[model samples]
Target: MKTKFKIIIGLLFFSLTTFAQKDQVKILKKIYAKEIITDADLVDYKKNATKYGDVAIEEEDKVYSEFYKSILPILEINALGANVTTMQKANFINMETISDLSSGLNGTLDFEKKTGKKLYTDKINETIRNFKPIFWEYVVVLDGQKKYKEVSQAAYLIYQLDKKDLERLYIAAEYALRAKEYDKSIQYYNELNALKYTGESTTYIAKSKVNDEYNAFSSLAERDIAVKIGTHTDPKIEKTPSRTGSIYKNIVESYIAKNDIPGAKKAIVDARLTNPDDTSLILTEANLYLKTEDFDTYKKLITEVLAKNPNDADLFFNLGVISSKSKDGQAEAEKNYLKAIQIDPKYRNAYINLAVLKLEGETKLLDQMNKLGTSPADSKKYDVLKAKREGLYKSALPYLEKAEELFTGDADIKSTLLNVYNALDMTEKAKALKAKK
Candidate 1:
């Protein structure tokens, strides 16, 4: 009889577990079916406020917040085991919310245009704020389940809903990049580039002033004077969005990450085609050539760019680098380095290179001095050579000191500066630098 009772107990426990799972699944489905807040819903809430009073109206207005809350349980359920049907249902819910919010935001914007009043601004902003957190939660859930394609899709939806939201666009592009969906990432980055040029315009409506009529009837003929004061008649002004240049850089990087050098080149070309006069894009193209080791192309491109904008310090610095790398370019390198420093006094790289060039010259002079014999006549010659070498070393002092001041934590710079200090007989400064590390 005891054995029979144990069997019955086990069967009851199994039945309870099965029923619990079914109930959880039912809740998940119900959450998915919850209606998303729409423009019409907002309108209804406003229209019915008088009939419903403040409490009922407030409850009705919590539709979006409530919907987001409803999905949390399903997200929790999916985190454990993640039933396929439940996951699909959650994605559907996300898609629906994205679509509804996007449509509602557009409609609200249109209403503002017509009414000249920001009626739904706060509501839309609140909904977006609520949606963003929950949207990220869904992304985490999908990403944890290794549903990368779904994650990208959700990210793309968020971007479409608010193209002006650069953070969302960047997240979408990064997700696509991580999934090896290079084409998708490129598309998103291109969209970002397009939207970057079309900046948001803000409009403000000014209130009109009222006029009062004053009459004096003391004389035979009464005269009425109309006075208008504190009236605002200024027209609404719209400010265009500022142009941003980093999107092209992002696109090029995405292409390079996929080992598509030609694609990166083409992206720069396309950006230039649109923004021919954009110096930043031209500089980006120059950098692309430099990265690929096409020195000739980089030089030619930068030369053309410099002709247009010669005051650019970075361009002068790049020219200095190119000159420094050439076979017989000491003089040219020095000229370019000096030019860069003249344009920007705080140019640390220019200072470092100038100092290194002087140091190299001093080192060669020292080598020649060391090669001299130890005879009395040779000793006299060595003294002259050593004096010349010391002068050359001293020439590097100002630049090296400036470089050290500009960048304190660089070990290479500090080491080079220490060498310079020792060569110039500045023992105190060298000891101080050595004590730092």
Candidate 2:
């Protein structure tokens, strides 16, 4: 009877031990089989990590051990130093997949499990902050090495990780642009813009100093005094932390790059409806017109902008270029160029272009003179014409000299200056320029 009882106890204990081992094996298999970690798994792990203390540690160790074993061959292959093949690259990406899973597991197991603790909150925030940079670094490396498939896989994983992270979306868009995936890039940028407009936080109104001085009047003196004691604060000035304009610009540029003119125009029009007075968007529209060679519309739009903000020297310079495209536009070009110079004295292109217009005028006059007859009557006419041509050259000489001074190494400017000196009979200066060349 005693022998039979011992045998029965032994059988029961063996069965129970076998059952526990099988359960542990099943847990490990589930972890090892995961190719991509989902949010639900993260949430479940968070619950388990908090609820099951030492049991969670034991299971986590088993999962991590299985992961390490699976990636061991890849780690060794990568250690072979610089002669990695496509198969090896694919293996590395597989390892990254496992690492991402490990990160999700560890993040939940270590930090998110302790939800209410300050230390847990801080550590989780730091982990979240570090996650993006690390993932982006990997993506950039794969891209630089031209491991395109790996990049695609990594980018997809990142997007899956956080659809709301605008920085991640931006990086994805940039990678897509690099990969010549314009449509995908546009899609990501659009998503980013949508998220930005829909989210809300806070707005604070505060007075800030526009200058260090304030205009004040003393009643006793009945005179205005410039008080320079403290900052001059303005209540009317308001500022907001916004990135919508830049996002709009990116979307427009991507559309333009894909040769989708209608799409780009639609984006610009939509952005304009929201930000009607935005000069940057207006400039983008003007640039689109310039790209399409619709100079009339470009000129009209820019003219309207100048009417609002006429002090933009670059706008004046651009107007000069547009005017030069029209027939009989030299005078208008000169006027615009002069205005640019008046606004910005050191404007190099303005000086160069003014000189070029003067030279063009001289060339036209000389062409007419060459067409004159060789008779005595025409000879007198030729003399008058010669004087006029010389006067034009003289008018161009100062502007050319200024341009030459501003850009000493410009061969075209130097050559033009040399021609002007020769026409004006400044023989010594012309000889000097010839020697310099």
lDDT of 2 by residue, 115-213 (tens): 433422343345345444555666777888987645755675666555455555566666666677778778877877666552223332323256443
TM-score of 2: 0.60
Write candidate 1's Cα lDDT for 1-437 as tens digits: 99999999989986775565445434433433445533443344333322222222232223322333333433333333333454454554565565555654655555666667774466456656655666677777878988776787787777665666776776677677778788888898777776664334443433344433222223222211111233433334345454445567667777887888999999998888877887778888888888898877888889889999888888888888887787788788899899999999989889988987776666677788889998999999998988888877788888987887878777888988888788778899899999985
Number of clashing pairs per prediction, in order:
0, 0
- Scored against the true structure, residue 408 in model 1 reaches a CA lDDT of 78
Candidate 1: list runs displaced more than 4 Å: 1-133, 136-154, 160-167, 174-183, 191-244, 361-388, 404-415, 426-437
Against the unseen true structure, what C-alpha lDDT does each candidate score? Answer: 0.67, 0.66
Q: Tell me, by TM-score, which candidate is best.
A: 2
Pick out the ten consecutive residues of candidate 2 with the lowest summed lDDT: 218-227
Could you tell me the lDDT of residue 234 within candidate 1? Answer: 36
The candidate maximizing lDDT is 1
